[model samples]
Target: MAEVLFYHLTESRLEEALPDLLEKCLARGWRVVVQTSDPERRDALDHHLWTYRDDSFLPHGTDADSSGALQPILLTAEGAQDANDPQVRFLVDGAEPAGDLSRYVRAIYMFDGHDPERLAGARRRWTIDKAAGHDLAYWQQSEDRRWVRKG
Candidate 1:
Protein backbone atom coordinates (compact mmCIF):
# COMPACT_ATOMS: atom_id res chain seq x y z
CA MET A 1 0.00 0.00 0.00
CA ALA A 2 1.11 3.54 -0.67
CA GLU A 3 2.10 5.63 2.34
CA VAL A 4 0.15 8.84 2.93
CA LEU A 5 1.27 11.44 5.49
CA PHE A 6 -0.60 14.57 6.54
CA TYR A 7 1.30 17.48 8.08
CA HIS A 8 -0.81 19.87 10.15
CA LEU A 9 1.05 23.13 10.30
CA THR A 10 0.48 25.36 13.33
CA GLU A 11 3.75 27.10 14.04
CA SER A 12 5.85 27.03 10.90
CA ARG A 13 4.54 28.36 7.63
CA LEU A 14 4.79 26.47 4.35
CA GLU A 15 7.84 28.44 3.25
CA GLU A 16 9.58 27.55 6.49
CA ALA A 17 8.59 23.89 6.68
CA LEU A 18 8.55 22.56 3.12
CA PRO A 19 12.19 22.93 2.16
CA ASP A 20 13.32 20.90 5.15
CA LEU A 21 10.97 18.09 4.20
CA LEU A 22 12.08 18.23 0.60
CA GLU A 23 15.68 18.14 1.72
CA LYS A 24 15.10 14.96 3.68
CA CYS A 25 13.44 13.40 0.65
CA LEU A 26 16.42 14.34 -1.47
CA ALA A 27 18.81 12.80 1.01
CA ARG A 28 17.02 9.52 0.51
CA GLY A 29 17.66 9.73 -3.24
CA TRP A 30 14.00 10.40 -3.97
CA ARG A 31 12.79 12.64 -6.74
CA VAL A 32 9.91 14.84 -5.62
CA VAL A 33 6.87 16.48 -7.20
CA VAL A 34 5.25 19.42 -5.39
CA GLN A 35 1.72 20.16 -6.57
CA THR A 36 -0.11 23.36 -5.86
CA SER A 37 -3.57 24.60 -6.89
CA ASP A 38 -2.50 27.69 -8.82
CA PRO A 39 0.22 29.11 -10.98
CA GLU A 40 1.15 31.75 -8.43
CA ARG A 41 1.87 29.18 -5.72
CA ARG A 42 3.73 26.98 -8.15
CA ASP A 43 5.92 29.89 -9.15
CA ALA A 44 6.43 31.02 -5.60
CA LEU A 45 7.51 27.55 -4.42
CA ASP A 46 9.87 27.19 -7.35
CA HIS A 47 11.53 30.45 -6.43
CA HIS A 48 11.51 29.69 -2.73
CA LEU A 49 13.27 26.36 -3.20
CA TRP A 50 16.05 28.20 -4.96
CA THR A 51 16.58 30.89 -2.34
CA TYR A 52 15.29 29.23 0.80
CA ARG A 53 18.79 29.18 2.22
CA ASP A 54 21.99 30.73 0.98
CA ASP A 55 24.00 27.81 2.34
CA SER A 56 21.72 25.18 0.84
CA PHE A 57 19.82 24.62 -2.39
CA LEU A 58 17.02 22.43 -3.70
CA PRO A 59 17.42 21.94 -7.43
CA HIS A 60 13.98 22.18 -8.95
CA GLY A 61 12.02 23.30 -11.99
CA THR A 62 8.48 23.96 -13.18
CA ASP A 63 6.50 22.89 -16.29
CA ALA A 64 7.91 25.93 -18.04
CA ASP A 65 11.38 24.50 -17.71
CA SER A 66 12.86 22.01 -20.10
CA SER A 67 13.59 18.39 -19.17
CA GLY A 68 10.84 17.89 -16.61
CA ALA A 69 11.86 14.31 -15.99
CA LEU A 70 15.46 15.23 -15.25
CA GLN A 71 14.70 17.47 -12.29
CA PRO A 72 15.20 16.06 -8.80
CA ILE A 73 12.31 18.28 -7.71
CA LEU A 74 9.40 19.59 -9.80
CA LEU A 75 6.72 22.16 -8.99
CA THR A 76 3.40 22.24 -10.78
CA ALA A 77 -0.08 23.71 -10.50
CA GLU A 78 -1.63 20.74 -12.27
CA GLY A 79 -2.07 17.20 -10.96
CA ALA A 80 0.28 15.62 -13.44
CA GLN A 81 1.06 12.47 -11.50
CA ASP A 82 3.88 11.04 -13.56
CA ALA A 83 5.20 14.14 -15.26
CA ASN A 84 8.43 13.79 -13.37
CA ASP A 85 7.90 10.18 -12.29
CA PRO A 86 8.59 11.17 -8.72
CA GLN A 87 8.85 8.75 -5.82
CA VAL A 88 7.46 11.43 -3.48
CA ARG A 89 4.55 13.81 -4.10
CA PHE A 90 3.54 16.86 -2.06
CA LEU A 91 0.08 18.43 -2.16
CA VAL A 92 0.28 22.06 -1.18
CA ASP A 93 -2.20 24.91 -1.08
CA GLY A 94 -5.32 22.74 -1.17
CA ALA A 95 -4.24 20.71 -4.20
CA GLU A 96 -5.74 17.24 -4.43
CA PRO A 97 -4.68 14.21 -6.34
CA ALA A 98 -6.08 14.06 -9.84
CA GLY A 99 -5.94 10.34 -10.52
CA ASP A 100 -4.24 7.16 -9.35
CA LEU A 101 -1.84 7.88 -6.52
CA SER A 102 -0.64 4.32 -6.00
CA ARG A 103 2.21 4.99 -8.39
CA TYR A 104 3.89 7.20 -5.79
CA VAL A 105 5.86 5.64 -2.95
CA ARG A 106 4.78 8.40 -0.57
CA ALA A 107 2.32 11.29 -0.79
CA ILE A 108 2.28 14.19 1.65
CA TYR A 109 -0.46 16.71 2.32
CA MET A 110 0.54 19.93 4.07
CA PHE A 111 -2.32 21.96 5.49
CA ASP A 112 -2.50 24.96 7.75
CA GLY A 113 -4.29 24.53 11.09
CA HIS A 114 -5.65 28.07 11.03
CA ASP A 115 -7.49 27.45 7.76
CA PRO A 116 -10.68 25.61 8.59
CA GLU A 117 -11.34 24.79 4.94
CA ARG A 118 -7.93 23.19 4.61
CA LEU A 119 -8.39 21.31 7.87
CA ALA A 120 -11.75 20.03 6.66
CA GLY A 121 -10.21 19.00 3.39
CA ALA A 122 -7.47 17.11 5.24
CA ARG A 123 -10.11 15.30 7.27
CA ARG A 124 -11.92 14.33 4.09
CA ARG A 125 -8.70 13.08 2.57
CA TRP A 126 -7.88 11.13 5.70
CA THR A 127 -11.28 9.44 5.60
CA ILE A 128 -11.04 8.65 1.92
CA ASP A 129 -7.48 7.39 2.10
CA LYS A 130 -8.20 5.30 5.16
CA ALA A 131 -11.19 3.71 3.44
CA ALA A 132 -9.05 3.16 0.36
CA GLY A 133 -6.60 1.10 2.48
CA HIS A 134 -3.58 3.33 2.15
CA ASP A 135 -1.17 3.51 5.09
CA LEU A 136 -2.10 6.79 6.74
CA ALA A 137 -0.25 8.96 9.26
CA TYR A 138 -0.73 12.36 10.85
CA TRP A 139 2.04 14.71 12.00
CA GLN A 140 2.04 17.84 14.08
CA GLN A 141 4.87 20.10 15.12
CA SER A 142 5.76 20.10 18.78
CA GLU A 143 6.74 23.22 20.72
CA ASP A 144 10.36 22.34 20.05
CA ARG A 145 9.63 22.49 16.29
CA ARG A 146 9.93 18.76 15.86
CA TRP A 147 7.38 16.74 13.93
CA VAL A 148 5.62 14.18 16.06
CA ARG A 149 3.22 11.60 14.69
CA LYS A 150 -0.22 12.21 16.13
CA GLY A 151 -2.21 9.46 14.45
Candidate 2:
Protein backbone atom coordinates (compact mmCIF):
# COMPACT_ATOMS: atom_id res chain seq x y z
CA MET A 1 0.00 0.00 0.00
CA ALA A 2 1.08 3.54 -0.69
CA GLU A 3 1.59 5.48 2.54
CA VAL A 4 -0.04 8.87 2.83
CA LEU A 5 0.57 11.06 5.86
CA PHE A 6 -1.46 14.24 6.11
CA TYR A 7 -0.17 17.02 8.37
CA HIS A 8 -2.80 19.44 9.58
CA LEU A 9 -1.36 22.71 10.73
CA THR A 10 -2.65 23.61 14.18
CA GLU A 11 -0.67 26.80 14.50
CA SER A 12 -2.10 29.86 12.79
CA ARG A 13 1.28 30.46 11.21
CA LEU A 14 2.79 28.19 8.55
CA GLU A 15 6.39 28.99 9.55
CA GLU A 16 6.00 27.13 12.81
CA ALA A 17 5.01 23.95 11.01
CA LEU A 18 7.46 24.01 8.08
CA PRO A 19 10.62 23.01 9.90
CA ASP A 20 9.07 19.96 11.46
CA LEU A 21 7.53 18.91 8.17
CA LEU A 22 10.77 19.31 6.25
CA GLU A 23 12.74 17.42 8.91
CA LYS A 24 10.26 14.58 8.89
CA CYS A 25 10.35 14.25 5.09
CA LEU A 26 14.15 14.40 4.99
CA ALA A 27 14.50 11.82 7.70
CA ARG A 28 12.21 9.53 5.80
CA GLY A 29 14.35 10.16 2.66
CA TRP A 30 11.36 11.48 0.80
CA ARG A 31 11.80 13.94 -2.06
CA VAL A 32 9.22 16.65 -1.47
CA VAL A 33 7.20 18.47 -4.13
CA VAL A 34 5.38 21.46 -2.69
CA GLN A 35 2.45 23.12 -4.47
CA THR A 36 1.23 26.42 -3.08
CA SER A 37 -1.27 29.00 -4.27
CA ASP A 38 1.04 31.73 -3.07
CA PRO A 39 3.79 31.98 -5.62
CA GLU A 40 5.92 34.32 -3.53
CA ARG A 41 5.84 32.04 -0.51
CA ARG A 42 6.55 29.08 -2.76
CA ASP A 43 9.52 30.89 -4.23
CA ALA A 44 10.72 31.69 -0.75
CA LEU A 45 10.59 28.04 0.27
CA ASP A 46 12.35 26.96 -2.93
CA HIS A 47 15.06 29.50 -2.16
CA HIS A 48 15.58 28.77 1.52
CA LEU A 49 14.44 25.31 2.44
CA TRP A 50 15.16 22.87 -0.41
CA THR A 51 18.65 21.42 -0.77
CA TYR A 52 20.05 19.19 -3.47
CA ARG A 53 22.52 16.32 -2.93
CA ASP A 54 25.27 18.72 -4.02
CA ASP A 55 24.55 20.74 -0.87
CA SER A 56 23.42 23.76 -2.86
CA PHE A 57 20.05 25.37 -2.21
CA LEU A 58 17.56 25.53 -5.08
CA PRO A 59 17.02 28.89 -6.71
CA HIS A 60 13.80 30.88 -6.66
CA GLY A 61 10.93 30.43 -9.17
CA THR A 62 11.63 31.44 -12.78
CA ASP A 63 15.31 31.79 -11.90
CA ALA A 64 15.38 28.01 -11.84
CA ASP A 65 14.80 28.00 -15.58
CA SER A 66 18.18 26.37 -16.21
CA SER A 67 19.29 22.87 -15.26
CA GLY A 68 22.09 23.27 -12.75
CA ALA A 69 23.10 22.46 -9.18
CA LEU A 70 20.66 25.14 -7.97
CA GLN A 71 17.83 24.35 -10.34
CA PRO A 72 15.11 22.25 -8.83
CA ILE A 73 12.00 22.20 -10.93
CA LEU A 74 9.35 24.31 -9.20
CA LEU A 75 6.26 23.16 -11.01
CA THR A 76 2.94 24.94 -11.10
CA ALA A 77 -0.30 23.01 -11.61
CA GLU A 78 0.07 22.98 -15.38
CA GLY A 79 3.72 22.05 -15.24
CA ALA A 80 2.88 19.17 -12.93
CA GLN A 81 0.89 17.38 -15.64
CA ASP A 82 4.00 16.86 -17.73
CA ALA A 83 6.08 15.83 -14.71
CA ASN A 84 5.89 12.10 -15.18
CA ASP A 85 9.54 11.45 -14.39
CA PRO A 86 9.92 8.85 -11.66
CA GLN A 87 12.98 10.52 -10.16
CA VAL A 88 10.92 12.69 -7.82
CA ARG A 89 8.11 12.24 -5.33
CA PHE A 90 5.75 15.14 -4.58
CA LEU A 91 4.58 16.68 -1.33
CA VAL A 92 1.67 18.89 -2.39
CA ASP A 93 0.56 21.55 0.11
CA GLY A 94 -2.28 23.40 -1.56
CA ALA A 95 -5.96 22.79 -2.25
CA GLU A 96 -7.29 20.06 -4.55
CA PRO A 97 -7.42 21.70 -8.00
CA ALA A 98 -4.26 23.65 -7.31
CA GLY A 99 -2.28 20.57 -6.36
CA ASP A 100 -3.19 18.61 -9.53
CA LEU A 101 -3.25 15.52 -7.35
CA SER A 102 -4.26 13.08 -10.08
CA ARG A 103 -0.61 12.71 -11.06
CA TYR A 104 0.44 11.31 -7.72
CA VAL A 105 0.09 7.64 -6.84
CA ARG A 106 -0.77 8.42 -3.24
CA ALA A 107 -1.64 11.58 -1.37
CA ILE A 108 -2.01 12.93 2.13
CA TYR A 109 -4.76 15.51 2.49
CA MET A 110 -3.81 17.79 5.35
CA PHE A 111 -6.23 20.14 7.01
CA ASP A 112 -6.38 22.29 10.13
CA GLY A 113 -8.97 22.47 12.93
CA HIS A 114 -12.13 20.50 13.55
CA ASP A 115 -14.03 20.41 10.31
CA PRO A 116 -15.15 16.95 9.29
CA GLU A 117 -17.74 18.38 6.93
CA ARG A 118 -15.08 20.08 4.85
CA LEU A 119 -13.06 16.90 4.84
CA ALA A 120 -16.07 14.90 3.75
CA GLY A 121 -16.76 17.30 0.94
CA ALA A 122 -13.23 17.03 -0.38
CA ARG A 123 -13.46 13.27 -0.16
CA ARG A 124 -16.63 13.27 -2.15
CA ARG A 125 -15.13 15.38 -4.88
CA TRP A 126 -11.56 14.17 -5.20
CA THR A 127 -10.78 10.84 -3.60
CA ILE A 128 -14.17 9.24 -4.17
CA ASP A 129 -14.45 10.38 -7.76
CA LYS A 130 -11.07 11.13 -9.31
CA ALA A 131 -8.57 9.03 -7.42
CA ALA A 132 -8.71 5.49 -8.63
CA GLY A 133 -5.98 2.93 -7.89
CA HIS A 134 -4.57 5.15 -5.19
CA ASP A 135 -4.73 5.38 -1.42
CA LEU A 136 -5.47 8.63 0.35
CA ALA A 137 -5.05 9.32 4.03
CA TYR A 138 -6.83 12.14 5.85
CA TRP A 139 -4.95 13.66 8.77
CA GLN A 140 -5.76 16.41 11.22
CA GLN A 141 -3.69 18.04 13.94
CA SER A 142 -5.25 19.24 17.15
CA GLU A 143 -4.12 18.27 20.68
CA ASP A 144 -2.25 15.50 18.89
CA ARG A 145 -2.07 14.03 15.38
CA ARG A 146 -4.70 11.65 14.11
CA TRP A 147 -5.38 9.98 10.71
CA VAL A 148 -7.99 7.86 9.06
CA ARG A 149 -7.88 5.92 5.79
CA LYS A 150 -10.15 7.61 3.32
CA GLY A 151 -9.83 6.15 -0.18
User: What would the TM-scores of all predictions be?
Assistant: 0.97, 0.52
Best by lDDT: 1
Segments in model 2 whose C-alpha atoms lie over 4 Å from true places: 47-93, 97-106, 114-121, 124-126, 129-131, 144-151
Worst 10 residues of 2 by lDDT: 81-90
Candidate 1 lDDT at 26 equals: 97
**Cα misplacement distance, residue 150 of candidate 1 (Å):** 0.6
User: What are the RMSD figures for all models against the true structure?
Assistant: 0.9, 5.9
Identify the leading candidate in terms of TM-score: 1
Candidate 1 lDDT (Cα, whole model)?
Answer: 0.90
- Model 1 regions more than 4 Å off: none
Over 101-137, each residue of candidate 1 has an lDDT whose tens digit, in order, gives 7888999999998899999999999998888889999
